[model samples]
Target: MKAAPPKATFAICGVTLLSFALLSATDRFADAAVLGGFIPARLSGLAVPYALPVWLTPLSATLLHGGLLHLGFNLLMLYFCGRDDEVALGRPGVVLLYVLGAYGAAAAHYAVGPHSTSPMVGASGAISALVGAYAILYGQRRPSKFSPEVARWLHIARLAAAWIAVQLMLGLVSRTQGLAIAWAAHVGGFLVGLIIARPLLRWRYRKA
Candidate 1:
């Protein structure tokens, strides 16, 4: 059977790419980041110069990227994991995951640094959710001496540990480079994905 096109993924990638290009070209990238990016201080009632509403910044932040490398990495992950996830969860499910992931990332970021003035940009946090869902939906199961349930949880624990380690390393690297990486947002987004993967799957195939 022929597979359905991943319209949701394509749309998201297209919009994100176009948004970055237009903002960069018009020299409004900085403005956009300040106005649209998720700022932890915004949640703490910090006023800004004509910025978007605090509640909407998380979704808006997904459309902004720091640089070509940042955008490329996110789009690539979205294309791969998103296409496959769309197949299992359908368009709505994928969109749901992405949107929820963005908010989840922002919330986590805020929790860690409520007074932070840095604006969190890029789609990585949202993409992390998709990656998390992908891990759950398609991750390989290995042979283990433990019972199936115990082994399953152990597998999740390992994945979580590995993810955190990688994020911490990335955070360290970014710190040295004078760039901030929201490792907390990534962790939060991934947790959201892991928590919702089964429910979304069941919702998709409810009639089956």
Candidate 2:
């Protein structure tokens, strides 16, 4: 039986939506994005005007989205995957996973696009981490005839492959439209989710 969705999941969604509404209402959407979004170049000391301080952008970026479509897709993913994760990992664990995932996303963007000034906005990276945690926890539900360790690794490999393929395809599509997709950040966040889910699950069980 499925557990009730955790309150933190809804609260995070509410915060994201409320912040988006307020930011959009108070300034040009582009202006807010520029001011709050993660721009790797800012950390690299580029001259991008209106960019937030380098230290602030990673967390701030999670609260900004390019459009309704962007926000909607992320919130949808976050609700479903995040609910499952929260059920398994608890509220504090989910929030920690999300914050670390955002940092992971920013690290990946810095590794790949250190000099690029494009502001990376949206909750997709953090949501991708939640999806990864969900994949690890729920994807290996049935006991396999193979060794449990082998089965778990195999499941993760399949999920990772599918995720990488989809992100690559999205990257191509974004490029065609003259936009950057930050596939690296997605991969980074997903990797963090996969890595931490098991430990977080154990910690939750221990606490119980």
Index of the highest-lDDT prediction: 1
Candidate 1 minimal-lDDT segment of 10 residues = 170-179
> Please, what are the lDDT tens digits per residue for candidate 2 over residues 60-170?
989987566666767888898888899889999999999988988888878998988888877778877897898888876677998877887788788777766765665
**Given candidate 2, what's the lDDT at residue 187?**
85
lDDT of each: 0.86, 0.82
Cα RMSD, each candidate: 2.2, 2.8
TM-score of each: 0.88, 0.84
User: Can you write out model 1's per-residue Cα lDDT over 84-153, one digit (the tens) per residue?
Assistant: 9999899999999999999999989999999999998878789889988988887657888988777777
